[model samples]
Target: MRSLVQILAAVKELRWYYWGIIICSLLTAATSLLTPFIIKEATDEVVASLQGRGGGISVVLWLAVALLIADLSNTIISNVGGYLGDVMAARLRTRLSQRYFHKLLTLPQRYYDTALTGTVISRLNRSITETTQFMQSASNNFFPMMLTLVASLAITAWYSPWISVMLLVVFPTYMWLTTLTSKRWQKLEAKKNSHVDIAGGRFAEVIGQIRVVKSFVQEKRELASFSDHYDATIGLTRSQSRYWHSMDAARRGAMNLIFFGIHALIFVRTVQGAFTVGVMVLLIQLVNLAKQPAMMMSYLVDTAQRAIAGSRDYFEVMAEEQERDELADPVVGGRRELAPDEPMIEFRDATFGYEDGVDVVHDVSFAIRQGERVAFVGESGGGKTTLVSLLLGLYQLRSGQVRVAGHSIDQTPAELLRGSVGVVFQDASLFSGSIRENISYAHPGASDAEIEQAAREANAHDFIMGFEQGYDTLIGERGLKLSGGQKQRIAVARAMLKDAPILVLDEATSALDSKSERLVQQGLDRLMKGRTSVIIAHRLSTIASVDRIVTLKDGQVDEIGTPEELARSGGIYAELLALQSGSKQDRKKLKNFDITA
Candidate 1:
């Protein structure tokens, strides 16, 4: 959660695995150094035997046995360490990914509104996979390599100080160069990832709305745009690959030259009789062992840098302010109490907007008593939906007050109102689930019988049974597999299952054809009875039976009366009704009615 090493090290459950890594690394290094010593011993033994020295064969036999044990144990321990590293990496991935997912769920609506789904998904995927790999790389590769280097260097220094001096001088320079190259690569790699994210977002956006694309005949245009993004991403990736290859080649070239020089020096020393051939062989082996870790350092450094960058992006999302869960906290010195018998719903001078100082629902004041069927009719953007959103506590008030069930909304717990008010939105949003599942969504533990009854009441039972799978039929994404009316009926079934004491329907049946609308309206009428209902509709006939109609214009209430009274008033409502009443031919003669205009 912090720096790469700190984050990995902080996993308490992996503490034992980390200890195993350290112990196994040390053991592996010890065994690795022992093999080269045994080689030196065998070489010495063969030289002594050729010179007719005593116990030469037995000495070689002992060294061979030691060599076998060292190499086998080293292999076994390294595998064990690698296994432990994988386990730790998997745990880290699971825990952090879960945390990120939960954080995503907690984020406010504004984040979802602005962030592209593809970009968010890409970041989430990389953050978990890359970060864990970076940690595992450090633990299994980087740390073990460092241990090997230390063990090999110690042996080399003990045998030959002159050789140790050369290693000290060349190795640090090599490491510094690798680090510098890795830093540059990390930056370029991050840039490449950005381009990839942009391309992914573009791709997802176009594909998700494929229907609209074909309808508008913009497939060719969308393809051109996506191609442009993808090409840019490919260009950035190619540049990054070029830099990586160049750095790798340069590192190898430098390493080969340095090692060759060291070998040449060792050969000269041996020829001058300064050291035996055995000593020369051991130094060479040690140098090679040390070089292995040094070479791995570059790749590990690159991974660490990339992980840091990815984690930063990941944590940045996690740091966003989450939606408030307080339900309601009353304002200081404001109304702290309410009458138990007050109207079921009241909005007193309530003003709010998505932005400050620009009210969408301006100074709106109204009240609906228990069991009242009140309808709100307004043109688009006249704040009909916004008002409903306010009542549902989807928004905070900029001014005034909203009271529900005899309690000030700011003082009442949100769950209290949420549990009491059932809403069927215009879109009838449904998940990719079975019909029974969708109906039970409002009440997850609802019995099958209860679900069936709700579906029957919503008039969705007949159509639902017509499917081969009946209630178990899989609805495609957003229930696209179902017809518009089917989805609406299922939505109503969901609301009916909730059996809330209050209901709000925002153009719930607006999208259905005449026959579908009639069927859905019948269910809606049953749902609205014996409850405090708020209906927002554009089709005047659908709401003609409501007890009262509140008309809005330019963010204020323009009229409030029974449908009969409003029709007789010759106001905006009367004009709208007359316009709809005209014959199809006559309607074409009149201009379209726009209340806002």
Candidate 2:
């Protein structure tokens, strides 16, 4: 119940509809109570005086007609209220979903470091679906049941105090059974969702690495793993069903017992004419009417418990405090005006990490002026990648200052920073879209002419033209249809399209062959003409053309100088060059060098 309140608070924007849903359900409960009087009148007064009062039949018929109209009206209004509840749920679901996506995109890179890709995906999908179900169920049923239960109890006590006491006693017993059992149901619901999430993760992993699985001939093993998860989810679901059904059975049996007990007490009261015949019949009809609200209340319990349980988990992700975007002063408008002809980037004694307890990049500082290409080369566990991530605003600096385009990185707006810095990650990240869309991603509204120009600058235009549909050709998932170098070139073209003043080249050309590498080298040299470029490279052979090389070893600057100058020092960089360049440099070794270059 506490969790349900929290989830409902998220959709508080549609308060009127929420109230409307409750009110309509109360109306249904009210109308149901009135029908009992009509039944009693027909049974006692009209039948007893069939030939005595000429108006007796007319009175009974009119009341019957009134009851019919009331029931019909109640049904219509309830359906309308249900429809409104659905609409409200849909609207909130959409808003929450969009927010969830932007949250992922803007979240610190460290969040992804420990978060599994499939776990994130499951929350984005199943968690949101359950949340929407909660909103619908709560508005359509939960609140209404509470209203029905209260209204019925009040009216019941007003009509026949003794019999109403019976309902009061039985109702609580039924409620206690349902609620006590719901605790176990809630646990199973969460476990059920967890199992599904694991299944989804394994499915994504298997599909992604199908080729590897095939080569290893482990298809049967993967299928068995998936089947086990499915069965676990199914088992939990069955248990959840039985838990609720037991409550339903107990509730129905209790209602029947209450009805018999009330009627027997009423017959005894009517013996001395203390209660008229019509009144006795009315009590009987009312006795059944009394259960309407109780039954609705029970249904509401079932729906609300399930919805709220699922919603609690969903809100866990949605309610995560977002990273603060507080800036001293936020900049606005296009990034064009702030572009520097000979831009300079400076990191002044910066210290930062992905989490609070441990720092990854310690008191580090560097400066790069326009047209000066600098590379950060290091072993795998060093801080080279961390440095690049910090520069890209994927992680905030814990201390010191990072300035881009002569302005403080902290003072710069995140949107503005995103527009200004162009990066190509080592994995050659690409989405499912046309080749043209992939290039023009940073600036979505870029024209075809701008896109073609950028592609040509990245030396990808010629190859793109060779595709059957040219720029319109669709790339498969992760650009799997394209070769490694092809994907890298497309990613390069995307950065080129951004046309930012500063570029972070994190091994952007590492996957290319000698000829393709040479072609891209000329394009990159031209593109870096007046921009501050920071490169994270592993191939010592490739840094010869760069203006300067800064080697990272064990999280500190091992050597900082030109490739030739650093080689003369006989440090980590020199040793790496010696190991990489042999009489026959392993092509595979060179491939990894290119990958991390």
Candidate 3:
């Protein structure tokens, strides 16, 4: 209950609805308190009729009407309070979901590399539902119970001071029992929620990679793993339920003792002629009202514990500091004005890695003149992709500087830096949407004619038109429905639609078949015509037409020259060319040179 109050307090912007809930709750409680008084009045009239003194049927009629009015008001107002509570829950859920998504957008690349996709999704989905359920319980059950208990005690104290005093004593003991039970339940609920998360994460993982399960014929194994997680969750839930019911039994036993004591006190007072039968009836009704709060104690505590567990998870994500952009400060914005002869891209003593104090790309320096096509050739794990990531502002520099058209990458806004450069990766990413949507991703407002033109330039127009739905074709998840060559062409067409001044081809055509490679390469050639291009390639043949081939070894520049010049120089580039061309004589010469060195 305390935790639920804290949650409501933190969301102070919804105070107006909170006030509505409070008002309706108070009205319902007031109406309920009137029932005992009405019952007492009708009882006195019945006694008078039985004794044959001042027996008036009209008085009984008036009391019955009053009881009906009180009940009707209580029912209507309680429903209204329930409705307003749901409204509050909906708003809180929306605000939380929006915050989680917005934080995701602001998080740095390193977090994504380490975080599990399924776990994150499960956390976000569960937190909202659990928190809202708690709110509903608190509003509909806990709040009304407290109000009615308090109101009943005050009226009873005014009428029969002794009975009220006895109930007051029992009240604190019942609350103490509830408090102890809540603490233990909270710990158990936390453990239970973790099992739930594991189950949800596994479910999402299986759905996301169903193809792998089918290929490996591991469906039985996967099912067994999921069953283990589900069993753990159910086991924990059953344990919690058993513990709750035990505590509830104790609470009910204590309430029975209090009820018996109160009834005895009323009977003695009536026998002593200090109280009438009508007053005893009223005292009995008040005792029942007092028991109501204690009876609801288990439910309220369980809900509060669950709510606290969920809110803790939700706020933990919210507490993560959003990744701050180095270039967040305002700057004079325009097409970075540079001298006509200045280099379009430059890296000077640039050193970077995902972690601090360890540089995978160390002390590397190079430059590409405007409109010059350059290719970077390197072995696996030679930091080729890291360099491209730096250019796109996906990472911050550990030391030194990288610039595009004389503008420092660290000082330029990430969106602006990425907007000026276009990229087509080896694995083309396409969402489950229409072909037209994927093509116009960078320029969502692009007209049909403009999209068609871009597709034509990328050699994708004919293939796209061949589909029954043409541009409206719904590609399955990640464009799996399309052939490798077809997916690559659509990716190329998307980049072409951006029409940026600089283009990056990250081994885009490396995985295609010979025929697919030819088609994709044709699209690539058209896309790179007027743009300053940087091609990261493994194949020597694909980069032959580039103005310069820069060979990297152990994170340093080993050679940079025209392909023909590098082939004659007999350095890393020439050796790589020799190995790929499968020249036996050159391999023997290189092996002999390596032993001598």
Best by TM-score: 3
lDDT of 2 by residue, 1-597 (tens): 777676567667878877777777777666655666667666675756765853666776787898798779768877887898888888877877887787787676677777667767877677677767866876776655556556656765776787778878877777877767788888888898788778887888888878899999999999999899889988888888887787688877887788788889889888967676778877766665556656766666766766676666666766666555846554445563445552477778888766666666677777787657888877675787777767767777889888776777677777777778788776778998899889988989999999999888878888999999999999988898888777878887888888887888777666678877777777677677677788876655557778888777656667788888888899766766776776465434544333231
How close is every model to the real structure, measured as TM-score?
0.86, 0.87, 0.89
RMSD of each: 4.3, 3.5, 4.2
lDDT: the better of candidates 2 and 3:
3
lDDT of 1 by residue, 1-597 (tens): 266665665467778988998998888888888888889878877887898983676788888888999989999998898888888888888888888898887665557767888888888888778899987887777788788887777778887777777776666777677676766776777787787677777778877778899999999998887688778868877887788778777776787787777888889989999878788788888998887876775677667767887887777777788756655554333323335568888999998877445888888988998899998876667888788878877677889999886677676655666777899987889999799899998799999999999999999999999999999999988898999999999999999999887899988987789999988998998898898899877777778899998988778888989999999998767867877888887555333322221
Model 3 segments beyond 4 Å from truth? Answer: 1-12, 53-55, 169-171, 178-184, 325-342, 355-358, 583-597
Q: What pairs collide in candidate 3?
A: none
For candidate 2, what is the lDDT? 0.74
lDDT of 3 by residue, 168-259 (tens): 87767777877767777778787877776777777787887899999999999989987887788788778878887888788778877877
Stretches of candidate 2 off by over 4 Å are 48-51, 54-61, 141-149, 234-256, 267-281, 296-299, 328-343, 351-360, 397-401, 406-411, 585-597
The candidate scoring highest on lDDT is 3
Give candidate 3's total backbone clashes.
Answer: 0
Local distance difference test values of all predictions, in order: 0.81, 0.74, 0.83
Query: Which ranges of candidate 1 are over 4 A from the true structure?
Result: 1-3, 6-16, 54-59, 161-175, 178-187, 247-252, 272-275, 325-339, 355-357, 392-403, 406-420, 564-572, 582-597
lDDT of 1: 0.81
Question: Sorted by TM-score, highest first, which candidate order results?
Answer: 3, 2, 1
